[model samples]
Target: MPSFYSKKDLFFQLFENQNCLELTQLPYFSDHSKETFTLVLEAAEQIAEKSLYPIFREMDRQEPQLVDGKIRIHPAMGTIIRKFGEDGWINAIFPYEEGGQQLPWVIHLAAGFIFQASNYSASVFPFLTTGAANLIRTFGSKELKEKFTPKMFAGKWQGTMALTEPDAGSSLSDLTTTATPASISGVYRIKGQKIYISAGDHDACENIIHLMLARIEGAPSGTKGISLFVVPKIRLDGAPNDVLTQGIYHKMGYKGAPIAHLMMGSQEECEGYLVGEAHQGLKYMFQMMNEARLGVGMNAVAIATAAFQASLAYAKERPQGRKISEKDLSKPQVPIIEHSDVKRMLLFQKSVTEGALALLIYCGILSDKIAQETSAAKKLKMEALLDLLTPIAKSYPSEMGVKSTSMAVQVLGGAGYTTDFPVEQYFRESRIHPIHEGTTGIHGLDLLGRKVWLQEGLGWKTLQQEIQHSLDQVKSIQELNDLGHSFEEIFLKFNHSAGELLFKRNLGPEKFLADATLFLEASGILCVGWMWIKQAISAQKAISSGALEQSFYLGKIETARYFMEYELVKILGLIPRFHAASYPTVTMEKDWF
Candidate 1:
């Protein structure tokens, strides 16, 4: 049977050949999202392949620059970024009421995999803009929306979320940017220096909208005192002002997008408008930050997929070694793929990239349900679940994405380790993800310190129920029966581990955070294991009946088994690493390092 990457027939069959994914059949997939996602993915692939991929190397070489007090990217990048937003590619999931396509979030993200993978650096522009726009459309007042929404939506303007001050990186409460009442109507004066703002300034659009966090007069100290403001680059009526370029950064990777140090309200008062309520800025801004976090996860998935595909293709064609079975030394070497170790590496990349893709895509669909379900109770429940899952979605992909991309370069041998190949660049580009929105440590804390215990443990219960359901389905599949049984046992062990951690809270909560990172890893694996089972089950019925081609079904079943056997089996290893008797990390102290 033939192998097909665009397995439309198989996808249709999995959703029972319906036009949209049937959430009723597969609760993980949201309804009425399949076709739209598929089509958008198709479109994204075209743009990525044609426009984005070719420019990746060039963008990395050029990087973004400050020329004569102006932020400049590769000359070609301006056109590409503009075209991206012009395609409505940037406005995929915003409300249709606000002139957006109103496509489900699932499709938006699934399509995004192609764009990011093809050209990760170039993709950050529209990605950050959408992040900024999400804040406005979600919490901005009607007048603010009216003034900003059309320009942002139509690609006439770009957007960014400016939260990090020089003093505050991950510790947002340390921010010192100031916000004072404006003489201008319905606006505030923003005076602050923002650092590491991606897409912070660019010539791609006429104006740039910065969603900045600052403190108001008489506001409480710390993060509670912060407020979000919209500060535009261009003066009103299309007048060009002496905006502070400050400086543009040269990063290790993701060179196409400018990471800028912007100084607003440095001159004649920079105009701004309040988003949401005063002192409620941090709370409201989370809506955008959470979405961006999920987006970072999805972006990692796409880039990882691209790296895997490239390396796999390179391995198959780049002959370098003899097959294991070959006895003749005089004969020419076979492809590197014939080597068991190389195959193992490629398969590792494949399994991780695929599993990450499935999990991220599933989260996107859940986002759709959070909005469109019309059930107030169901919406609240799903929102909480989403909140719990977002950190996992973002950090897991980052943690794994770096590994997968690294393997891709290893597959290329020496050539991949250099700038001559894109894999190395992919490796560098993916590094920013885990650190940007939030550090992995921060995300782990959010999962363990907050999400796990929130709402009287409701989110954990919901996830547990879903895991049980997946495990139950796995028991029925003959091929997965043994692995599924093993997963069930390991999962139970995790539940016990959680209980022990809580019941034995003698150590400081900070010490307890030792294995918390591992805890996140374990839960992520289980989540993917559950998703793998779903994919396998869907593949099974079709492969058995000969409705689907044999190779595709077999691959799904094999990969699913791979996750169950290797990934699910990992829970055993993690428990030991997590609950160590002595932490080499803590006990040794800083002097050891």
Candidate 2:
């Protein structure tokens, strides 16, 4: 199999084709160029291959354990994390004043994909830390930033977003964790139990900073009352904060990272500094949640990418049954890659994984655009469009990622099911992507229930205009015109189906969103179709210019065509059901099963 580094050109080309470098014109990213991005990717690729990938299976087999009331992870985790921090990867996207390179988020995430594809479980520690540091940097006070942000960015300390509780799950309103006024100004005494906290407690770092959510005394119930807190495992005075690690939850895969159950302030001594305001914790968390959602999707894409490459390599070397045309037993068996069914499976994985990477990287580009955009109206429009696409960005790559990995496994047959190969591990790891950040069902509801109709449905309308823009850009390209027209037709049907559902809003929640998951599925297909169309056009431009990597560009175009023909067409059959808005699931009684 080709090393993940071997595909650097494909990723960089996609990044450049998407105009990611435009962010350099922004004051924050002024120092960066295409060459700078290459330098960053090269550094990351070296770390991934040399340090992370070597221990991928070892870390999983050893797994993190709560030994003697302290979490102990694989020994190599400490070295990899130190390298990540010292290399400036933890702070790559932050401002230079904060000891960062001020690189564009697009490049940051592109490097992120390489690291993640190499070893997701081990790679998660830095990713989660970056997210936590960003949350505090964006919303924390000067004091909070001054004290903790620098250490985190320097990778001296680790950070985590701790939101899930034993009883609350995804419902923040039901949270019972409480915060009270502390002796120190802006600080509070916090008491709560958090569950399923990733990188919660590990021996790899000197300190663990948790961006936890809790309800303050006398605050209103539900999401409105939740408040954000900066809870550290060790206090500034060097005494342990009242944070206790109950245990590590054994997972099905990605076993290298530890997920902990934490009891905060069991001894009533946990000190937490409030972030932003008293009752806006949920809002702050959502900012982190949105970023995490994209990370989840990226992780999915990376896993499937690895699986595809592995399977493709295996298919080329593993000789199977003779070709159908060869009737004699004496004939030598050909490689399975010669089989049409195997080719189909490989193409399925390629289309889904590559298309997913494009969509996610495009999301990163949009994020940079929002930061550089000074126009208030345009920024608002972009924000709206991002809101509408977030669920799809999170859901499609994830849900389809599972299917793509399954296809990878299928290509490997029985070997894919056993521990002898990594495909089984990839399949196991991909399962959690759809369930993390937000489950597919949660995102489905968010898409249909809130985002679609926000700003008098302007979010949805703005997306339509963008899709039309892609269609216009490809109309003159001879080879893509038919695919373009097919996309336009499917989008029309999509709009009409959505229109019918919008018309039934007054029919109550059940009737309004009975088929919301299907709607999400259809919408995900449409979004990926748009991304593939954009990729194909980019490839055509490259081919017209006599680019050196002709085969790579051609492969992109072919994959886009395959996705349109086999995957995008599924929406046609789904539109009728989307329009139906049938309440069958809602109407079915609990006892029906």
Candidate with best TM-score:
2
Give the candidate number with the greatest lDDT: 2
Give residue 548's lDDT in candidate 1 (0 to 100).
42
Each prediction's Cα lDDT score?
A: 0.76, 0.87
- For model 1, name the residue pairs that clash: 12-17, 321-334
Which stretches of model 1 miss by more than 4 angstroms? 1-20, 23-37, 239-243, 504-506, 581-593
Task: Give residue 164's lDDT in candidate 2 (0 to 100).
Answer: 88
Model 1 global lDDT (CA atoms, 0 to 1): 0.76
Q: Which tens-of-lDDT digit does each residue in 1-593 have in candidate 2?
A: 24543364345444545877777788878888878887888788888888889988888789898998889999988877887888888888887787878888878888888888889998999879999999899999988989998778767789999988999887778999899998888899999899999999999999999999999999998899999999999998899999999979999989999999999988999999999999999999998899889888888998989898889999999999988888998989999999989989999998888887888888888988898899999998988988898899999999998998899899999999988988888888899998898889889889999999888888899999988999999888998888788788888888888788777778988877787888899999999999888988988988999888789889888888898889999998887886674567888899988
Give the per-residue lDDT of model 1 (tens digit) for 42-144. 7877777778777778988887778887787777766876787788877767655666676666666656666777788877777777888888878889888
Considering only N, C-alpha and C atoms within 3 Å, which residue pairs clash in candidate 2?
Answer: none
Candidate 2 stretches greater than 4 Å from native = 5-13
